[model samples]
Target: MPHFHFHSVRLVKALLACAMLLASYAGAAEKLANVTILATGGTIAGSGASSTTTVGYTAATVGVERLIAAVPELAKVAQVKGEQVFQIASENMSDAYWLTLAKRVNVLLAQPDVDGIVITHGTDTLEETAYFLNLTVKSKKPVVLVGAMRPGTALSADGPINLYNAVLLAASQDAVGKGVLVAMNDQIHGARDVSKTNTSTPDSFKTPELGMLGYIQGNKPYFYHVSTRKHTADTEFDVSKIDTLPQVDIVYGYANVNPVALNALVAAGAKGIIHAGVGDGSLAAKVTPSLTAARKQGVLIVRASRVGQGIVARNGEANDDELDFVAADTLNPQKARILLMLALTRTSDSKQIQRMFYSY
Candidate 1:
């Protein structure tokens, strides 16, 4: 009888132990994380004539709290905090806004509890903002930027879903050290390559040549690769110390190109200019004199092809050898402008800036 009683006690002890183990497993399985959101005014914050309306819109209409409350499912992924950094329409966004946003991002990434960040931005200049962030923010932590094509009040709008996916990707451990990211249409893309391809389509944001790094599946982010570009919260590209970048302009090129625009920019004190030349970024014969005068005045000039792909040759039939101007290697003219301004922030030396055009 004593032996049987002892066996019963041991069985009870084992059952209690199993219950405790199961409880602990349940707790550990939870993906608890901390994330911060820096909201800038965009379509994500806009509203319409009615609470249920999603079409008609106004900028910076709704606050970050409303955006956060709109999607409660975020709690399942991370403990999120909201900070309204700016409440202006993205269309009104400018370099001042970019510098402000970059500084704020630098501050948030410095916090230890902050695992990631999500920014709501406008669609019009989303590419420019994304590229700026990609080049500046030095943190390796996931920085995801998202926006909506429709008002937050709409019935079939894309903001809620986009914000949800962005938060998920931002909180995921797999997303760290991958540079800044933009998530839209359920796709995750690197900041440098992603651009808006369609205006109003739900699947508008796209990354060309290179595809998305990964995708959000089953409400989770699955990234299979990483970008070779530099990024994160390291504060490598400080904004305050490097202000007053040279005035660089892009001049379009077509048949019968005129030198008037180039001459005007030089007169307007343009420190550098990018000629959107034809074919391999070659300028028309008529524009040669204007380019020469601009270069002679020490206005750094770069020739870039209007063609959608490939690098522009330095020694082309465009008479680049005599001009002493640098030719961009495959950078689109607009991208060339961004790179040029950023490079010029550090140095005005044409040779050093030329190296930047090639590397970045």
Candidate 2:
């Protein structure tokens, strides 16, 4: 009877150990982050006739499902799910699409199960979209925008690796509240400062003045800096109820510049104008009258430099107060347009808009 009782006790102990092992495995699986890839077609989804063809290829040819399938390694980092938000090259990305994407991101981030988001975009206008989302998204959840310079069908296509690194960034806890990020070539840049510096190349995206925020190594995200500007939930711009963005146009400033372009933009019902000036956002003496006249006609004018880097200081080079114009500060013309669009939704006051430029 004693021998039989001892064996029964040992059997019970073995069963308990087996149950604990299964529970441990289940816990580890549940700890994986739930990451969603919002694919808006770009060169990342592009294809070509030959693997060597990088240019003149058809973009947005692949879908999100195929993109995810190509990178099975993504499954190791997070529970990734793909959703096709739009199937157009990012150059064709419109204000309506921006609204749609922002709304969708907000909705997805609200879900308790979704930990972060990765957006696949075209390099052409990825910075614009990323900056737009930085100012408007209402959640602190990490939003990482990624794009490839070479088509996915290229011999050494960079899309898969970029996509994988982006997912890793989104799944990172350190990415939270860091505003929107642009991850490419294993480097992470703040959306507010990053720009497409090269026409075509895998290392095109750069933040000239502020530098990169972080980088990804071995599928792990290492952050070095945090953006000081307001963003995400801390930003005042909200796109939840916004239906349409205001009409803002960009005018290039060059030698022998004429007022016809500026006048034409105003004639075409442009609510705001961004003068991409030659140096320090300076307006040529020849074009100042037109800009002054436009501002007098209730049109908002902002001065941004064509020189890529440096700030267009208020009251520094131009008499922004006297002309009733706003300087673009450190923001490029493209990003300035995005801020002006959202600022117009709140108020058309130049003071308020200038304040918005400084803060955002």
Highest TM-score among the candidates is held by which one?
Answer: 2
177-271: candidate 1 lDDT, tens digit per residue: 88888998898998766777786777888877667888998988888767665555532456746545568898999998888888888899898
- Candidates in order have lDDT scores of 0.81, 0.94
The digit string of per-residue lDDT tens for model 2 on 1-360 reads 999999999999999999999999888788889999999999999999899999999999999999999999998889999999999998898999999999999999999999999999999999999999999888999999999999988999999999999999999898999999999999999999999999888899999788999889977889899888999999887888889988999999999999999999999999999999999999999999999999999999999999999989888778888999999999999999999989999999999999999999
How far in Å is the alpha carbon of 302 misplaced in model 1?
2.8
Give each model a TM-score. Answer: 0.87, 0.95
Q: Using lDDT as the measure, which candidate wins?
A: 2
Error of 2 at 341 (Å): 0.8
Worst 10 residues of 2 by lDDT: 235-244
